[model samples]
Target: MIAYYVHHQGSGHVHRASSIAAQARTPVVGLSGRPRPAGWTGDWVDLPDDSDGVDASSRDVTAGGTLHWVPRRHAGLAERMRRVSETVARASLVVVDVSVEVALLARLHGVPVVVVAQPGERTDRPHRTAYDLAERILAPWPVRPAGGWPDGWTAKTVHLGALSRFDAHPAPAAGDPCRVLVLWGRGGIDVGPDRIAAAAAATPGHRWVVAGPHPGPGAWPANLTWLGWVDDVWAELSAAGVVVTHAGQNALAEVAAARRPAVVVPQRRPFGEQDATAAALARAGIAEPTGSWPEPAAWPALLARAAQRGGTGWDAWSTGTGAARAAALLDGLAA
Candidate 1:
C-alpha cells in the first residue's frame, strides 16, 4: 500500500492526488482534512484542521518560524501526526503534495517520501529542508531550464508535465461571438469588478463568462455572465475562444488540455509562484502573460494576441499521461 498526503488548502492538491491515485497499481490510502472526493476507491483517513485550535499566546504554531507549520499543544496537530505515523508504518512509500512537516515526519519514520514540487521561490529553509530529505521530487511541469530549481535538486526530480483530469478530452470547437472564460480559484484574482465591466463593455462582440468562487460584488455588463463555481470546468474551457485565468498549475494544465489560448493574470502567491509559472508559460509560447492584471483598454490587444496563438505550444505541458507516469514512479518505489 502507498500513503498519499493531500494538502487541504485549495482543490488543486486533492484533484491532482485523485488523478494520480487512480492510475496507481497498488492500493492507495489518502490523508487530508478534505473529504474523499467522489470517484476515489482508496481508504481515506480524515485529518483534523491544524489551524482549528491555534493559539498564538499559548501554543507555538511554528518552531520559531523555522518549520513550515507545527502547532504546539494542538490536539488536531497531534492526532494528524499520529495518523500519519500509523499509516507510514504500514505503507511502503508516502507521497506528499505537500507539507514540509509531514515530509519530515514520514522520513523520520524511515519511509521513503516523494515530495511534490511547486513552482516558486523555494529557497527558504523549510522548503530546502524538505527537498533535502525527500527521496524523490515530482515536478508537475516539464523539466525547466537551469536556474529555476535549487542547486543540485533536479537530479532526483521527475518532471511530469501538467497533470490534469481532462487531458484526454477532445479540444472543443470555438464558439460564436468569441466566448471568453474567466477562471478564479480559491486565492481569487486581484482584478476588480469595474475593470471587468469596462473590459466587457469595450469588447461588446465577445461573450465573457466568469467562473469560480468570489467573482466580486456589483452587477455585470450584459456581455458578461457569471457562472460562479461550476463542477464542469472542461465544459467552460471547451466553449471558450480564449481563457483568462490565474497562473495556477491545475488551471494552466486544464487550459492546455482544452487547446485554448489564454491570457494569464497571475494572482499573488507564496514566493511569487504564479509569477514564476506565468513566466515559464510565456517563455514556452504557451500563453500570453501580464505580470499584473492588464488595463481594461489593453484587453482588446491582449485577447487578440492570445487568440492568434491558439494554444499551439501547450502539448509540451499537457502530456495527457502525466498521471500514469507519476503512478508508474510510485509503483516502482513500492516495488
Candidate 2:
C-alpha cells in the first residue's frame, strides 16, 4: 500500500502524482486541504469547510472568485492523522509532497518518506529535516547549480528530471502551424478576465486554450476555449504550435517535452513561483516573458522565436522516470 500526501495548493502536485501513481502497482490514498479534483483514484479525506473570509494564504478559485484556505479545525488534523496512521500501518512506504507535518507524522509511525519537489523550492528547515528522513529526494529539473538545497544531501538527492504529462505520450507532430496554449492557475489575481479578453481579441488567427479553475462563466472571450481543469491536456498541446501559459512547473515541463516553443506571462503574485519559472524558461530560450498582455505584435514575434528553437536539445534534462525511480528509492528505505 502507498499513501500520497496532497496539499491541494495547485493542480501541479496532484497532476504529477497521478502520472507517477499510474506507474505504481499498489493501493494509494490521497489526503488534501481542499476537495479532490475530478477523477482522483484514491480514498479521499475531505477538508473542513471555510465559510469565513479569506486570509493571506487562501487559494482563489477563478470560477466563484472566492479565496480558499486550509481549514484549521482542532479536531480535523487529529482525525486525519488517525486515518493516516491506519493507512501507514499497512504501507510499505509513504510519499510526502511538500507537507512538513505529514512527513513528521509519517516518521513517527516508522514509515520512510519520499519527497517530490523542484530544485530551488526546498529551502525550508523542516523540509531539509524531511529530506534527511526520506530515503530519497526526487528533483524534477536538470542538474544545474544546486540552489536552495541543503549541503551533504547529495547522497539522497536524485535528479529525476521534470515530471510531466508529455512523457506519457509521443512528442507533438512535427511542422504543425503555430497554435498557443495559455494556462492561468492563480486566476483572478494573476491573469484577470479583462486581460484574457484583450489577449483573445488581439490574436484571432492563432488557436488558444485557457485552462485552470474557471474565473467565471462570462469572464472568458469567445476566441479562447476555457477548460476548468483538464485531466489530459497533452492532446491540445501536441496539436499546438506554441504554448502561451503561466510559468507553472508542469506547464513548462509539458511544453518543453513536446519540443514546442512558448510565450510565458509571469504571474504577478499573491501567487509566487511564477517569476522564477518564467525567467528560467526564458533563459533557456524555450520561452520569453511578456510582462503585460493584449500585445498581439509582441506575442507573434515571441512565438516565432520559440518555433525556430523547437525540438532543439530540450530533452537534456533528466530521464522521464522520476516517479518510479523515486518510489523504488523510498521502498528501499522501508526495507
Winning candidate number (TM-score): 1
lDDT of 2: 0.63
RMSD of 2: 5.7
- Window of ten residues with lowest summed lDDT in model 2: 60-69
State residue 112's C-alpha deviation in candidate 1, in Å: 0.3
Off by over 4 Å in 2: 25-27, 33-73, 119-121, 186-189, 213-232, 268-272, 289-297, 311-313
Q: Kindly list the per-residue Cα lDDT of model 2 for residues 1-335, writing each as its tens digit.
A: 77887766666787677766666666667766667756667676564433344443443322132212234443554566677677777777788775666676787888777776553355555556677777667777766565555676776677777777557566767635646667555433455666666666666776667666665667555667777777667766777777677666676677667766667776654324567655565566555666656364555566667667665445764256766765565545555
* Alpha carbon lDDT of each predicted model: 0.86, 0.63
CA RMSD of all predictions: 1.7, 5.7
Q: Which ten residues in a row have the lowest lDDT in candidate 1?
A: 168-177
